[model samples]
Target chain A: MPVTENIYEPVKAKLTNIIDESPLIKTLVLVPEKEFSFKTGEFIELTLNGIGEAPFTPSSSPLVKDKLEITVMKAGYVTGKIHQLNIGDVVGIRGPFGKGYPLEKFYGKEVLIVGGGCGFAPIRSLLYKLIAEKEKFKKVIFCYGSKTPKDCIYKTLFKELRNIEKFQVLRSVDMADEPWDETIGVVTVLLDQIKIDINNSLAIVCGPPVMMKFGTIRLLEMGYRETDIYLSMEKNMSCGLGKCGHCMLGDYLVCKDGPVFTYNEIKGLPDIWR
Target chain B: MEITVESLKKITFFKEFDSVTIEKILKISELQEFDVEEKIFDEHQKLIDIFVLLEGKVILGINVPGKGKINLGTIHPGQLFSWSALFPPSISTAYAFADVPVKVLSIKASKIQELVGDNDTFGYKFMKIIGQTLSKRLSDTRFQLINMASV
Candidate 1:
């Protein structure tokens, strides 16, 4: 008889650092008892022990095996508890679940990334991977938006991204409470600022639902094929293994089938933006 | 450097116009340039020219009593602004400033009004474009309001 491993069991991870990203968002750096790994867009079920569990995509580089980072916005019960946690506190992590971005498809193509708010967490990880293999892609363009200058995350990362060859970073804020030098309006407006070779490009959108919807529409208008636009869909995923029907979308389960999907794969799915 | 019917056709506001209509527009339009931080228009100022951004950024804001100029949004290339010039009681609603070195196609509003009064078809198409621009700005403003209220 062959022994089977329990899938429900979570690997213990200890909080090592917490960086305040914004007034409402924090990035928790965790050191897992055992090495854990995941692809850039895949999610992990972060357990708060006695409190509860919530699904989050690791914000750290997947190439880094020992330490994982999860950026959390305090929006709900479990996430609120996770925000209150201190350094050295133990938490459980259940997965590196779901499919991530298809890097092979992105090779030899121009990659355009549109992200807003907390959605930058996953894209940041993806950026790390793309930067490591920069020679494979033709170019990378990133457009990001926030409600205000203060709401923007990873403030220092933008400077570093601008310094890299073949990488162009553009940012915008819906409203400028302070002096902001970048483009302003919604994230979609930044699409107009750059010249893209739509015939040889892939557009990736990850943001709040409104941003995602408008970003995808803008990309379509710019002549990108449906198959060339990728979206990160964050649904209410309960069981990351797909046993729970909580994250179902049309005929597919978001957790098992995707957190990342090409727009062509789920265009007519009901209430996808919601 | 030169303002022509062909150049106007490339602008979003004038893209749908016929060559004759664009030529009429060109007769009343001139290329204007502004340095960074230059104030282009002020809220409540009597308007004379309607503008289309040909290049660089423009910041639109309202002057608050104590908080100073509260930037509502930015105007990107190929966008129309100061449309208040087209209506009666032509008073600017928001102050416009160049956030970067900028170039714009400034059209005499009085000439455009005369053109609209003479040609109904031109009037309808031109007004339709302005209406669409207003609708998009309204939607963008509403989205910003919701974002301000959200977590």
Candidate 2:
């Protein structure tokens, strides 16, 4: 993981707009200093001046390169600085580091996407690609969960997204208060609401670690083969390269081999969903 | 409320029962309809009857401190609700309400035990289905509880 020019260089980008997704998250629209291209499931390092840098996936579509969208949640360190930034501010964008989701495998089959909280960031990249090439896939079902109506991200786009033919999007919140009449419960509840052809389908899951762990178990019980399910494993990516050693899960660097791995590939690995 | 053998067979809870058994079960069961927003059962209600959803949706909800009403899960078509009837001192653990116009087949708990006692085979088969559904619900509930507690 030497500083190779291709992987080490950071392209400059400017935040054109800021969207308040939740009280804690801001969706930043970036216009890169140069042309950029990356597939879904990959992430870029967002560097904020002297404050430092952290890894974040572009929640925007991979097909759209003119402006990239990164849904940044205020966790602790680097993200806190990002929340303070205003529009017209500039930041650094690095490698679409790591393997993007394997859309090639999903080309001819039905696809199930299960995401929770900010995990929707990477899944959104994959979702937009499927929408772009709708005819290539059989069916696409998206099951998303948020803590509440106020915490749901991408609310503005999902209404238009549901209009895609042969696609279904099911949303659930942990609790319902006012003016909310849709489903209420964990996102996995959507699995019961929708019917999937387990034999001919693939499930792509990303979310809080607990959701991933339990969601995997539920999918297994529902008869989905372990080989057909994919998970996004986002360990700490300090370098966005294999050199960091900080994001290691077994011998694999989450930044290098994944961000995406089939359940069969890492089933027995320790601390996988921890 | 119309209770027929065919209708009973359509219910997931009674799917394993034979037509004769289903016919007999229907004698002890009654068809129930719930209008939208109607509360079919309340939490901690003392009852020994379980419901099988035939049409529409029922939301099983529990009140969470600081969080208001959190849905335990959904009881979809062919799914069972008020499963406490199968256990002693049965009491509803959550409130069930019609999310939409709904129909269900209700079977009394005492009648279930009598039927099981009459046919050992039916008892085993009946309990097996209940166990599977209950365990799956337990697992999902445990997961949801963890998620809620974690937050």
Candidate 3:
């Protein structure tokens, strides 16, 4: 079903800071006047008036309600304009649309979160949520990859997340050069370093098309059932409410049917980017 | 893991075919490759074999008089297309082109008929797969038509 509603709620947030995640990507942390509550995998449509708007996942912990955060990669027109916005700038906020990861399922279950490049945003949110309630989950393993260390968003957060007692953070770069000492290759390669109890664990994947394609297959090979693999899809989501058809992945609309879907639910959908 | 006849036979539609029969069927099918932007099957072309896309994207297009080229839909991996010749009239109504470099396996229509003639069970299973393909394409066409009408 298409999302027929567009509830425009005004939110005033002071852009506390902007961290340059990479040359083309940045994270905007906003301390809103009021609390902004959202699930990790859900997204918000940020409006920039004349420049248009784009959909992004607020990568802040669900536990933190007074602040909002979004990691954005500068890809084309709208995101380019978004990159120009500075701290203290006011931006339009439209939604906390689409359901987040099945956090309830992860309770008492080991979870694997895999991501690549700027695709790491939503995965990071999932990671944070799991970490906030660490006692609930058995273990959390995060595997992330990017073209280079320079292009890795949330590069700093990796160190902090690794320091967490219950979390295992592994990172890789496609091609390594400058002073890099870590795993290298596609994100799937890191799957080798981490052990997954596929039967008892859930895998949440969000990344570029190529990354998810192989990641899903690898997870399946590791004995994870198709139903247990949750994929975060990326599409041209203009209206987070699913009014816009830009995010159509077969009969299902990515904005509504999912930004997050179980592999079994979407394996039959045609033209799935991942 | 091995895509052998045994594995093929496990698919619901291929359940009728035993290991030996499925092996024979695979022999008749040949892998074909198409370069990026290459035409796989043109509209009105006679269908000789059933094309199963194993990889890459295929663009299904139709020409409209007094208008221009219209993209009906696009097919990705695991999806099948160009089945127009499988039914009445036995001629393609739309063209199929490789939007990107593609790899596919083709089973000759004549060979399919032969296999079906020999084994009704195999025939029924094969027809089921074809029927599913046709149903999906019909729905996709309807969606395109609706989008066009709205335009």
Pairs of colliding residues, candidate 2: none
What are the per-residue Cα lDDT tens digits for candidate 2 across A178-257?
A: 44567777787789878788899999889999999988988898899999999999867789887978988787888898
Clash pairs, model 1 backbone: none
User: B28-133, model 2: which lDDT tens digit per residue?
Assistant: 8888899998999888788778888889988888887897776656777888889897787888899999999999888998998899899989889888988988
Restricting to chain A, the TM-score for each candidate equals 0.98, 0.96, 0.93
> TM-score of chain A for candidate 3?
0.93
Computed on C-alpha atoms, the DockQ of candidate 1 is 0.55
Q: TM-score for every candidate vs. truth?
A: 0.89, 0.94, 0.62
Q: What is the TM-score of chain B alone in each candidate?
A: 0.93, 0.91, 0.83
Which residue ranges in model 2 land beyond 4 Å of their true spot?
A1-6, B1-3, B64-70
Which lDDT values do the candidates have, in the order given?
Answer: 0.89, 0.84, 0.75
Evaluation by DockQ, superior candidate among 2 and 3: 2
Where in model 1 is the C-alpha error above 4 Å? A1-4, B1-24, B63-68, B115-132
Ranking by DockQ: 1, 2, 3
Query: How many backbone clashes can be found in candidate 3?
Result: 0
DockQ of each: 0.55, 0.51, 0.02
Residue A214's lDDT in candidate 2: 84
